[model samples]
Target: MTSATLGPLLAEARADGRALGAFNVITLEHAQAVAAGAARAGVPAVLQLSQNAVAHHGGELAPLAAALTALAHAAPVPLALHLDHLDDGPLGRRLLREAPEAGFGSVMFDGSALPAEENVAATAAAVAFGREHGLAVEAELGRIGGKPGDAHTPGVRTDPGEAAEFVAATGVAALAVAVGSSHAMTVREAALDQPLIAELRAAVGVPLVLHGSSGVPDEELRAAVRSGMTKINVGTALNVALTGAVRQRLVDEPGLVDPRRYLADGRTAMTETVARLLAVLHGAAPAVPSARALPADGISPRPR
Candidate 1:
């Protein structure tokens, strides 16, 4: 089935008081796995690619771009391709242009490392660019703690008033606010400020996005959604699953040099992880029919 735009899917989730799972994709296998998981769970999801992932593949967009578009076309449930955590100015602009042309539904312009005023200014420009191209824009306000590879960064927290002002000034489709969540945490122990989330929701009219969501526990995740989080960005969990699968596969077959043999297991692990998370994000029972249960060739699931 052809995937719908990310904006509509996220808007629907927000209106219905549900959260959409936004999983990061680093390779063709990751894209396929995420789409497959979305299909299995029978829910709308976002397949995002981080700037770090793009850089890993030699800074070229063609390979992953094609992979994402193809996966979207083949997905049985609504799927959106998103550009995640992009900080570089020139590269980000290129991605902004490439996303709509490649059939992506949304793009996130992450300028969190910059000062507050510059971050807002750069994000505002990115929001304008996305709007002009008819794409949904997600901007970050107040830097979230933790670096992608390095240890956590200290002294960054989002203010509700500043977030509201940022959203109003930038006109972004969604706002990612920092409320005590850090990125790249393998353990799910982060504490979320629920009252702050509610305050931010009241302050900013747009959907609230939670970055560094992989670090939050299931209960907190659900509570965040119940409070006001419409979109949750998950990356490290999927990475953990994929790496674990590959590692175990290699341990079972010590001399395996073939990429497909190992990567296939990684994909399966990722799919399972995605399926489980989709159910949680959609607030559906585990026994419910998943996206994978849909006819393998169907465009979309029948209306429930």
Candidate 2:
């Protein structure tokens, strides 16, 4: 399948009353498993590279960007590379200018930490750069409430009127609005404010994004899509899967010497995670895979 751009993928998913799933890639296994999972689900997905991911690989993105793009190109289903949650620092601005060439079809410029006016101006400049570069620019204003030693304010939420105003001022391709979900939640019980989501969707002209969505339950996710959310971002959930699988493999097979053995299981877990989430986004109940052997190629394998 060909690497795709956000415009067509968004249009296609919107037409089907489904939201696009964007999963973060922190490691090469994440990229490979996400691609294989999307292929198994037979849906397009965005393989996201976030600022934290850049730091994870080294303090630069070039090494990982090219490899992720190569994975997207080799994905069995249409996939796109996205730069997620990049700040407005020197490196951020430089990346904004170079992302298109780095094989990213979309980039999220996060000016959310800045004061209100500064956030607007920074986002507007990013929008301008994206406009000239033919890239889709995603913007986040304020914070989607969450906690991990209080990294983001736990109760702050996005106001619909403010969101509409920000959209008009910034010309962002999509907007991530804070409803009620918290980030990095291991439990699937975040109560989303459907009314607020509907209100924001009505006020904002662009597609609405639901970030920190791994904490959202299946029924809540379907309701969010029904209420007008168009893009769903999930991260910690996949990490949970990968880490758990790798840990279990090591425990169950103590003599396993090859790192590939545990890594393969981790990749398999993430592949299954991606496929299941795609099904949820498609408004279908997740199904258990039939008992069948998966191929052991470096690329994750799923029953076709």
Candidate 3:
């Protein structure tokens, strides 16, 4: 864990003019691949388990969370476990109240589906819960949209002045803003409003987050970081890589029925993609701290 929190790394990224790559973890393979990639890159990484992913595992969190905690402990570079896209109030609240014990260091209280005022209220409550529980919290203000399974409607942009006010009212650690990126994009074609990103960076005090980064091109993602985005969230890109590799592996060896063989290839593919993404986000500079800086038990600083 390297005594790293999302806040300090984000603040450091903002100060250093780089962006941290936050990858979503769906299974043990996903966790291993992400951690392996980050270690290979020698940079700090965020391994996030999303609400949808939790649901896929029968709504149980303990086993997965525990495994990810162990993986973080054993990872060569710093890694943080985060609960991502927690939108449903009941489920989100429950996870906020319970997940700290399961080793979640942070949570994203997504309220983009609600009306603006209602969203702010829900996010404020979540922020309060996070503060009480000693967890770093993030919330989305504007609706970042996409083709399918996305939370918000399209064409909704974040207002800089309102964003500043929202931060004041919610006290969130970071804000995910809509700057032309959409979720579930298969291709890297989303055109971002660099000027708007810059404006939001200037208006908001906390580090800015860019969700659905899998849709953005490497150059555009780099440009977004340059425009002041500190954390970049990517998911679909890794899924694409993993599934593609699995398909290719099966085709190459039709008689191979072993799950481990196929899944190992998928993990390798995902690892390669994650390493590339990290390089794009932060270049070759090492972002992880020395192992000596972290606790011997692999637990880092907790908010209080």
Candidate 4:
């Protein structure tokens, strides 16, 4: 039950022509649900903490990161902690410095807001920190379509040649490319450029990551993986699923008032969603361990 880095797992996925699911953690329930889902799928998954999630907690990442690390220790399947979509350079550096203490195995230092040259420089600095800490580094090239200002403008897809150069310059272990997916889309109707994805796969040496994957349909996701996307990032889908479950729970039991009571349904719903997405990403249902193999609370049995 020891915690481990994401390098070997991502590399294995790329080699096997399968993809890993990286779910975003919003609350303690989210951490449990993600781990539980991954356990059910019998596949390793990444549990990510986004910058917005940090803002929600008043910028204190240590508490959540500690909880995720503890949960990872007792997870039935391998789980890696990742800091996702980090745009602030100072924050990214601080996270990298404290990553070992927080038990983060990898990070996605997002510099997509910067011009290409600046993005490379900033990301390369993050990569330097990763080298020092022995944690995997993931950087994005081209804007991934979802920022508030880009709604009206055409999406900036990542070019294969540029992707190759970016990887070489930054030395990132993973590269997230824009191939028609956007962040925070509630509807699952994003149209991906499959040919572009294949081209990036052939051009870039590192594993390709697909961000804003919640907007993609099941078949499209499978196609993206088949086209060489090794890591798929999902956030909004879990939020929508959890919120819908909570709303239904409230209506079904009007007397319910306790947060725990309402949140239980959300946890269940998220767990189900995670399992389904994991199954789709892996392309088959893996044989999970028996119920007794997992901790009752889906967290570490050892003392925190």
- Compared with the true structure, the alpha-carbon lDDT of candidate 1 equals 0.80
Query: Residue 96's C-alpha lDDT in candidate 3?
Result: 75
* Number of the predicted model whose lDDT against the real structure is largest: 4
Count of clashing residue pairs in every prediction: 8, 0, 0, 0
TM-score of each: 0.89, 0.90, 0.90, 0.91
Q: Where in model 2 is the C-alpha error above 4 Å? A: 147-155, 287-304
Q: Give the TM-score of candidate 3.
A: 0.90
Q: All candidates' lDDT scores?
A: 0.80, 0.83, 0.83, 0.84
Put down candidate 2 lDDT per residue, 132-169, tens digits, no spaces: 98899999988776733333665567899999999999
Cα deviation in Å at residue 190, candidate 4?
1.0
What lDDT is reached at residue 211 by model 4? 92
Candidate 3 lDDT by residue in tens digits, 1-304? 4425576777788899988899998979998999999998889999999988988998888888889888988888888889998985677667777777888878999887788889889999888888887788999887788734555566678899999999999999999999899887766677889999999999999989999898787777878988999999999878877777777777778899999988888888889879978988885533443313323332222211
